[model samples]
Target: MTQPRVAKDWYESAGVRSGPRRMLEEDREFGLEVFPERLVPHLAHEGLADLGAEGRRALLTQHFYQYMLFTSHLETKVVNRGAALVAHGEVDIEVGPEARLDAFKIYSDEAYHALFSLDVVQQVEKVTATPVLPYDFGPRMARLDRTVERFLPDHGALGHLLQVVAFETVVTRFLAQIPRDEKVFRVVREVVGDHVRDEVHHHAYFSRFFKELWAGLPPRTRSEVACSMPHFVNDCLRPDLGPVRAALLSVGVPADRAEEVIRDCYREEMLVAGVRDAGRHTLALCETVGAFDFPEAREQLQLLGLAD
Candidate 1:
C-alpha cells in the first residue's frame, strides 16, 4: 500500500522557508519590449512582427492580466467552498477540527493566491497602463459549473470534495510552468513562482485529502459520484480556447487567419494530450477509486480518449 502524504505542518512540508513571496519593485520591468512568445500557441504568428515589440508586449500584457483575473475569481470559489465543506462536515463523514484547521490553511493559501494573482494583475496594469478587461471564466467553466450544480444541486459535500480535490490536484500544470519560462516579465516569474511554491503544498494537501474523502463516501454515493466525476474532470481539464480566439481577433488578426490559428494552435489531439498530461494526477486518483468502473464515467473517459 502507498504511504499517504500528510498535509499537517504545512510550513515545514511546503518548504516555504522564506515565508510568503510577493512581487517587488526589483521584480518589475518597466516597458519591456520583449513580449512573452510562449503566452499562447499563436507564438510568432505572422502578425506579431508587424505588431512590433511594443505592440506585441501590449497584447500579451492584456492577455496576461485577464488570464489571471479569470482564474483568481474561480479559485475563490473552489477554495472557500472546499473550506466550508471541511469545516461543516459532510454527509457521512466529518473532516474534524484538526483536518478543518488544515483545510483552513489551504483556504489561507488559496485566498492569498487569489489576492496576489489580483495584485499581479494590478502590477501588470500599473506597469503596462492596461486594465484587466472584462473577462469571465469563459464558456467552458461556466457551462461545467452550471451542469455540476444541476447534477448536484445541493453542492453536496461529496460533489464539492471531488471537484476541489480534482482541480487542486491538477492545477500544478499551470502553476508550475508560468514561473520557469523566463520569456515574460520578471514580475510574472516572481509572483507566479511564489504562488507555485504554495501550490506545491496545496496539491499535496488536496491529493491526500481527496483519497481520504473518496474513501469516506458510502458505497452507493461513491458510485453516483464516480459516474459524475469524469464529466467534472473533463470540464476541469478543458481549456477555454475562446479567450485566445478573442485575443487574436482584438489584435486585428485577420478573421480567417484568426480562426485558422486557433484551430492549428488547439488541435483536438493536442488538446487531449495536454489535458491528459495536466490532469494526470487527478485522473489517476479517480481511476484508482474506480471512477471509471461505472459505464457512464467510462464512456465519457473514452470519448475524451482518456481510456479504452
Candidate 2:
C-alpha cells in the first residue's frame, strides 16, 4: 500500500496552531463594505448590478452569509467525516500511522475552520442586522447526499469516501481567489486567507490518499466509483443559483425579474465554464487513475460538458 505523504510539522504549521479565531468588534467597522462585489458574479448582470449601493450591499451580505454557512457545514459534515473515517480506521483502506495521524490533524483543522466560519457568520449578522436566510445544508452537500443515496444499503461509505476524495484533492480556486481581492472586507479575507493556507497542505495529503485508495480497489469497484466521478465533479463545482435568486429578491428585485436575472447570469455556458475551471484539479486526479477510461465514465463526462 502506498502511504500518503502526510503534512510535516502540522503542530507548528497548521492553522489550528494559533487556536480559534474570533471576529473583533472593530473588524465590522474596518472595511467600507461587508463583502467583495467581485465575489458575487451574478451582480455583474446589468439588471442586478444596477441595484445601487445599498441594494448591492444587502445582496453581498447575504451572499457572504451563504458562503460562510456553506463552508461551516462542509467542514463539519463532509470533510471531517472523511477524516474521522480514516483516522479511526473505519475505512477499508490500509494507511500508515503517519497518514492516520495527519487525518487527526486534518480533522482538527476542519473543526476549527467550522468554528471560525460560524463565528464570522454570527458576527456579520449582528453587524449588518441581516439574519441569514434559511438554507438547507447547502446546495452542494444536498446534491452530494442525493448522489450517495443511489448507492444505499451497501456502497454508501464508498460513495462518500470518493466524494471526499474528489473534493479534498482539488486546488480550490475560491479559497485563494477570495482573499486576493484586497477590496474585500478585511475580516472576510483574513478568515479565508487562513483557510487557504491550511488547504494547501490538505490538497497534497488528499492527492496521495487518492493514489492509495485507487491502487487497492478491485477493478469492478473502481469502475463503479469511476462512473460517478463526472457527476461528482458536476455536483461539487456547479454554482448554486438558489441563494443568488433569493438574494436578488431580498434586494427588492421582483420575483419574476429575479428569476430572469439568475437565468441570465448563471447561464448553461457559465455553469459549464465554472466546472471546467474549478474541476480541473479533481478531474486530473481522477484521470491519474484512469477513471475516465471506462466508456460509461467518459460518456458521462462528455455529457456533463467536462470533455468533448
Candidate 3:
C-alpha cells in the first residue's frame, strides 16, 4: 500500500522560497515608514499593567500559544497558496509589487503584536497562581479546532484572505476603543494606528480577490457562498465565553447569568460591531472590484446581521 505523504512546512517548501523573499523585501522597504520604535515598549508595559499580575500572566500565556498556532496556520496558507499562484503564473508581478509592499508592512506589524502578546503571557505565567493558556479555555479550543478544520483547508486562498480581513478589522476596532492611558493606551494607539493604515490596503486586496473568486464561480456556487456567509460571521465573532463565564462564576454571579453577563460586556458589543463593519466593507470592496451589485449583496449581508 502507498503511504500518505505528509504535508511539508510551508515556509521551507520550494514554492514559498521566492514569493516570501519577494514579500520580505517589500516589507523591509515598508518598515521605513512605520517601525513603531517609539511606541512598542510603552504599549507593552501598559498592556502588562492592565492585567494585574495574574491576569497579565494568563493573557500572555494565551497569546503565546495562540500566536504559535495562528502563525503555523498562516505560514501554511501563505506557502501553499503562493505556490499555487506561482504554478498558474498568476503572480501579478506588475500590480503585485504594490500589494506585496502593503502585505509586508502588515506582516511586520503582526510580528510586534505577536511578541507583545507573548511577553504578557510569559510574565502572567510567572506570577499567576493558575495561568491560563489559550487552549485551556473550552470555547477557544473548540473554536480553534473548528477554524483549522473549516477554513484551513488544503486549498483555501479565498478563505485565507477572508481570515486576514476578519482579524485585522476586529483588531483595528478593538484598539480604537481601548481606554486611553499614558502607558498602555498610548502604545496600543501607535501600534493599532500603523496596523490600520496597512489593513485598509489589505482589506482592499481581499475584497478584490474575493470578488474575482465569486465572479468565476457558477451561479449555484455563488448562492451557496451567500447562504453560508452568516454562519461564517457567527463562527468568526463567537468569543471564548468559557473564561468569562468562569470569571463571573468565581465572583458569585449566578451560573445561568454568567453567559449573559459576558455577552453584555463592552467587548462583546465591539465584536459584533466589528463583524458588521467587516461585512459592510467587504461588500463595498466587492462593488469596487466589479464583482457584484451593492443592492443584492446588501441583502445577503443583512441576512448575516451585518446590515441594518
lDDT, candidate 2, at 197 = 84
Clash numbers, per candidate: 0, 0, 6
**Clashing residue pairs in candidate 2 (N, C-alpha, C atoms within 3 angstroms):** none
lDDT of 2 by residue, 195-250 (tens): 88888888888877877888888887777777787777788777678777777888
lDDT of 1 by residue, 1-308 (tens): 03323355666644233445556463445544223556456656664457665556667766676667766866787656866677566434556566666666767667777887787777657766755566767575566666567556654556766677767777545546767666556777776777777777667767777677678767666666766666666677766776676776676777887788777777899878877777777788888877777787677678777773
Displacement of residue 166 (Cα, Å) in model 3 is 3.7
lDDT of 2 at 101: 81
Cα error, residue 293 of model 1, in Å, equals 2.5
Candidate 2 whole-model C-alpha lDDT, 0 to 1 = 0.78
Point out where model 1 deviates above 4 Å.
1-21, 24-36, 47-49, 138-141, 149-155, 171-175
Candidates ranked by TM-score, best first?
2, 1, 3
Q: Which candidate comes out best when scored by TM-score?
A: 2
lDDT of 1 at 216: 72
- What lDDT does the true structure give each of the candidates? 0.66, 0.78, 0.41
Candidate 2, run of 10 with poorest lDDT: 1-10
